[model samples]
Target chain A: MPYHFYNTISQLRQNEELVLYDRVLHFSEEDEQLVKDFLKIEYETESLNYPFTPPSCNAAAALWGAKTVYTACQLILYRENKEAELPLLLPVYNNEMDAAAILSADLCLRFLPQALQQTKNIDPDDALIAVLENHLQQWHYSGIGYVLNAATVNFDTVFANECMQQLYIDRVIQKKDMQRAMLPLLQKKITAAMGIYSATFWKELNSDKTHE
Target chain B: MAEDTSNHLVYWMQLDLVHKDYLAQIRHWDNLKIAADEQSIWVKDFTTSQLESIVLKSIPFTHLYYCKDNLLFPKSSLLPVGKQPAFLWTPIERALPVTLQGFNHNFFGIQQQQALRLAPIEEEQKVTVLLATVQDAGNYILNAPSIRLQQLKWIFINNKDALIIGEPVLPVNGRSYWQKGRFIFPVGYAFEFTVLEKIAAQQIDSTGTHLIWWIDEASYCLLHPDVLQPLSIASWRQTISNSPHKI
Candidate 1:
């Protein structure tokens, strides 16, 4: 599995560079002229389509990069620990949102609110841990499983399958209590993302106006 | 005296075992054990709810059955019985794809009472596949062009019933589409090929054949002949993106 991951990443890196080269080489005279004009701008500007280093980036980032990070982290951790085998990095089993939610609610009640006043909604100390627990280190293995099974086999499919599998297992264990606690937070994030996407979309559509 | 104490301890154990939250109730037995040893007595307060709850949770796949709404869960289909419509009361965790082979094979629906009937037999037949984003086509309804559009719209038709001499175009969630319900097709959908060839040899008929697909989930249909779904194109496009492909 590690070898497969390594090969896939290398192939993806090569493919990304090749695609950008191809696009730049194959552009028509008009597109070439547009590129030249854009280059005249002193500030760095990204191509609307294939701008970033590897060129294109999207949801697949969650699938590929996230999974890669997850697998690599496990391997490195095992090596450092000098363990005979890698630990099944099933984070959700222990540190799911339900556990966090209960802990956070309890903490909020236990600790004085004034102590957290200098920080954002949640205390800075608590926030750092939450970000690590919920976002980065949480359930990477499980998310990958869900993506692989459910989504079309692509860059992100593995992550999607793994994620879903973890969610399913977690759902079984925690039942409705988990969903009830997490839904509001998930909904808020989703809504915020939608807003950003639509705004960017509309801005791109009227990009000609910016030039005018 | 020892025999009497053992019998009394058994009675408390029995009461704890019968409770809804039997595990929590059973924990009380530790206290009972202490009390019995110290006082030369046995006692317990076991609630029926605790034991019953424990029993309910103990059953494997109990929640899965609850999720499936007591539907017969088949691991694999041996007999290719004509497409049976059964609602998945709860959505599956995994994503299902829309592909030529899938159109020939898979069926999906919500867990509800819908009709399954025989398809019309025709010596030569075409299977129509409709591919669209969730935004474009809300839900696709297929019927021969000969059928009145207005009446077809008004009347309810089972998927199999409409697909006479035809296979249903399995709705796969396209990549761009949000993963939500059974109807959301995330992958760009594909219909079956005109010529069915042996899987290994991969031979195709020389003569041209086509299946009409209603694109963008509209009433309109485009006829495709001998062409594999253009998934490679979308993939090549994504290749330009920095992200590595997982699928």
Candidate 2:
């Protein structure tokens, strides 16, 4: 069977062999259209603020998605740190993100957190940890579940896009990243959004901790 | 506390000042009732024993939200007596993006009326009680309820600017509907209530359907299409001086 990006990741997630990433893999025409439709629909369904702008053409977007998953999985399973080569393989994303990029990357990124957790359990200091973290900072939406350096985010770029900022806050809340929730700007937005229902909505969140 | 002799449901308020809101229930008056009293809320012993001994103030709706003291009728609905009242467990139909006027206190009835405007209700929903209908909402950007009588619990929990029906921040279990570039919970009554930031409302009511905004019988307001505001008693009489819309 032709390699499906999610299925490939699922295999890796189950500790299956790393055989698929080696092939010159490509999704069929039907799969590319499916990827495009999913990203478009999800952007509208999860309205953050701004409108969705496709990152590139349909094929390019799908390819980037496949590449992101393969690379993240390899980084998790392989012994060598693939840090230097990641940028060349999946060029550093532009400062402003497209709905396509975030959603496409998300197919794997959402699952990446749990997979990485297993690695941490086995080897906390594994070289793969640092490599995957760099990948996360580049794709901070996925990093919602991972603890990465927030300072490394391109806020100026993200804030420029209302959709990105809203989605970021949403993902943060979705992930329940206490560290990010404590950010001054984000705390205000989250508080205002929750209004009087903080007790019912996000009960565990302690606003006082942000001050310290 | 007096023993119950009527089938009418009784409710009490519990305040959680830390959250600036409270819950309602069917329990006996406790410290929370004492707190409610400090806010000038009147409570009744509710029994055949003292019904005539007290001064029974006139209220617009009785048995609907029965509370007694020496003076003042209830102005708000009570919360669930248990997790919710049995009647609230029964759901009915309501249209969403509807504006709703609710009782102010957690469960205690206050004198002043509190109205809350909810938005983007695109269609009908199954809720708990019918409360009261606006009859004429006057203008439409909105919708009301056969509301679950128990939503009285959240009468005061303004959690998120826009409610996600019942979803929390994490959408892992959320069933929000995707419409016009935003996510919405089709139902206002949720497992509990979850919230999100408000999104742009669906364009104004094109159908001119008669939408409702539930108002408790504690007080009443009629909307006049001419000025798009709630008509007071005098104004209601003036508008209907010539029209048959008057009761």
Candidate 3:
């Protein structure tokens, strides 16, 4: 699985060099110039859909690079924003080149605080807590999907409780309006996630514990 | 002298004659002298003169019959046959896979009704035999049509301080019959020639294909090739054959 980071700034910085190479190698002179022009012009929530073949398109490279740099500057400017509202409200950035990396990092960072708290509260008798701690540390360093997959596959009571708690916290924090329609949908997702985690976990548990 | 309660003296004499004849026929087969060791001492008590008088004057009992393995005994010798057999044959010490084919149905009720189709036995493999007889039960008398021996059973025997593993249930059938009662045998155990059911003569379906490994008496596991594969004699055939004479 591809590594993802919780920190958007770190991801943007890492992708900067690759984005630069893509522009130089793949972009035609005309498209490159067009990308440069597009970067200079900005609008407030305007439909800024840049037409370019992602990764190979000069315009796409320029737009992604520009967005990364722009976002980094915005993070700095909004660093003092007590609620971090501007960063949270930023447009959902999905481009093929770094989509997985960005999303995974975001999820890791989003859950890291609760995961750490939950780990602290974990029972000493639980063997799986240590594993979760190690995975959490790896998530911080590797900024990847491995932690999620590992937790999912080797789910124990402690890890599952932590995941559920994290989900509840996320739901409460994200959905302040509390629409009645979305409640059941969110509950269903939570149920489905736990069901899958339990199934995989039990299967591994039974096979591993076999006497023969 | 202990009185023959059933007045089976003539019957016993007749059986003794059959025993002598059977012994003569298989004398060469007893290379290890096991039959000599196991023969009943009662055979010696009856004299030729006594036998001649009984043969001339006495009528044989209806249930009396000579069974395989040189055994001559009354069929109704034991009453209330539901209990486990009292007489158990000592497990053959140096058992070979080839010899087991002949002695597969060593147990009385286990009739080899059908030909056993098994994988070719490798020379190295050895098969062991363990037999038990109900003390009073006569030959061919059974309490139930079928008896369940084990359930979800895994057997391990230490041989030469090394563990010999045996899965009684065939693995494929075992998947579905995991919790369901299934008959399993030890490793290198013969699958065919062992009767899972002993129905009455009228109930027997002679024309139907009889599978040694069973689903039921009429419906057998042979119909499902997967179920028969593991229990197949070839699966247990090994390269090293144990000599019966060694023991």
Candidate 4:
């Protein structure tokens, strides 16, 4: 029902504001576990050692995350000329984006990169691109290796949590993503972590010492 | 500016992805055309290496300059990833530092007069850097006094891009060394953090040149960097010159 609701909202099939999952028992136990399964895998890949513990799936988080992804995918793929209403449909998320919130939302948000790619393929000039791109940056754990707009990435929220920062760095190394790795915030820490043997670990870290 | 022979700048001319071809097998590689291993293949004379071009074309590779007295340097760790480049003239399009006479970057391997001779990075493979902690009293190797004379030699020899003066001072503590791969300094004792290099004495200015400039890589900033691995500018640059110019 939540998936249907979000997808309908994006397709102009519905225009309702999102609802929280707290105090709502609309989904089954199996569904909650299934959603948590997605976050678990992404956490492992990211080296997030925060100990994925019991009741990992928060109901409100699952709904918000699923809603965001389902609506985003539909809008990205189908909302061609419907550019003006993008912000209205997928408004900036002003939620408390702590580690728990982000981890919880990754349940369905992880598919964001694939959806974004599909939309880009359909119509690169799609208005929905920016809308979802902003969301992808927020839900970046799922977007690992997806090559988001690295320059615009604000590390304020990421650095707020110790565990998330570590996970972020690990994923960057796991992918050997040079673009994100070279960011000033990450560069210093990663440089110190790898130390003088930087070349031995990641040769791709070299800069193009040439001049224009 | 002084030049370092060990390291070199790599200019990339990306291959079209539409074309289906793998790197050609290596048949011959020399110091002038050093293909020590597949990681990097330094070509001194880009013109005569017609045969080498065949292998190069198939595989992704970067090349360095053949400058004065084999002093090849000016490392580039600043290129963006993920775009293919169109190089009309890969080497000439950019300037080498005045040290080598025509690179945009002012970081010449030379300073005043002390020139540097770089050794090959293809050092003894599989040797890890030793890490030891030194305690002051008994020379427990915790970053001081305990590291024996031998282990210190191994790390300095391997990682010193710049040359060191004389031998390392033995730790004041008793003989001790750890086997982990960390480059911890032997604190407690006075140690100089000089990078290793064969400094060439000089009096020429390494800078203040009316260097030419252009958007050398603006057109290719989006180029993918997978094939570009310039040699480790891992060597050190020290101006032992009486009057060294700022590089």
Q: How well is each residue in A103-197 modelled by candidate 2, as lDDT tens digits?
A: 55664456656666877988897655665667778777767867878766765545665545655665676667887787776788766555565
Q: Which candidate's lDDT is highest? A: 4
- Per-candidate Cα lDDT values, in order, are 0.26, 0.42, 0.29, 0.43
Put down candidate 1 lDDT per residue, B165-232, tens digits, no spaces: 11223333322211111122222432233222222112222223433323233332223332332221
lDDT of 2 by residue, B148-202 (tens): 1112211111211111121222212322322211222233422121232221122
For candidate 3, lDDT tens digit of each residue in B51-70? 34534234332123222233
- Compose the digit string of candidate 3's lDDT tens values, residues A96-119: 423222222332133333433443
- 10 residues in a row with least lDDT, candidate 3 chain B: B140-149
By summed lDDT, the worst window of 10 consecutive residues in model 1 chain B runs over B147-156
Deviation (Å) of B204 in candidate 1: 18
How do all models score by TM-score?
0.19, 0.40, 0.20, 0.36
Q: Which ten residues in a row have the lowest lDDT in candidate 2 chain A?
A: A46-55
lDDT order, best first, reads: 4, 2, 3, 1
Task: Return whichever of 3 and 4 wins on TM-score.
Answer: 4
- Candidate 4 on B95-205: residue-level lDDT in tens? 111235577586775665532222223222322222222123112221121112222322112121111111233323332221111121221211122242111111121
Weakest ten-residue segment in model 1 chain A by summed lDDT:
A17-26
Candidate 3 deviant stretches above 4 angstroms: A1-69, A73-184, A190-198, A201-212, B1-247
Best candidate, DockQ: 3
- How would you encode candidate 1's per-residue C-alpha lDDT over A53-167 as one tens digit per residue? 2112122222322232333333322323322222333122232233222222111111211112322334444332332233222332223211112222122321233222223
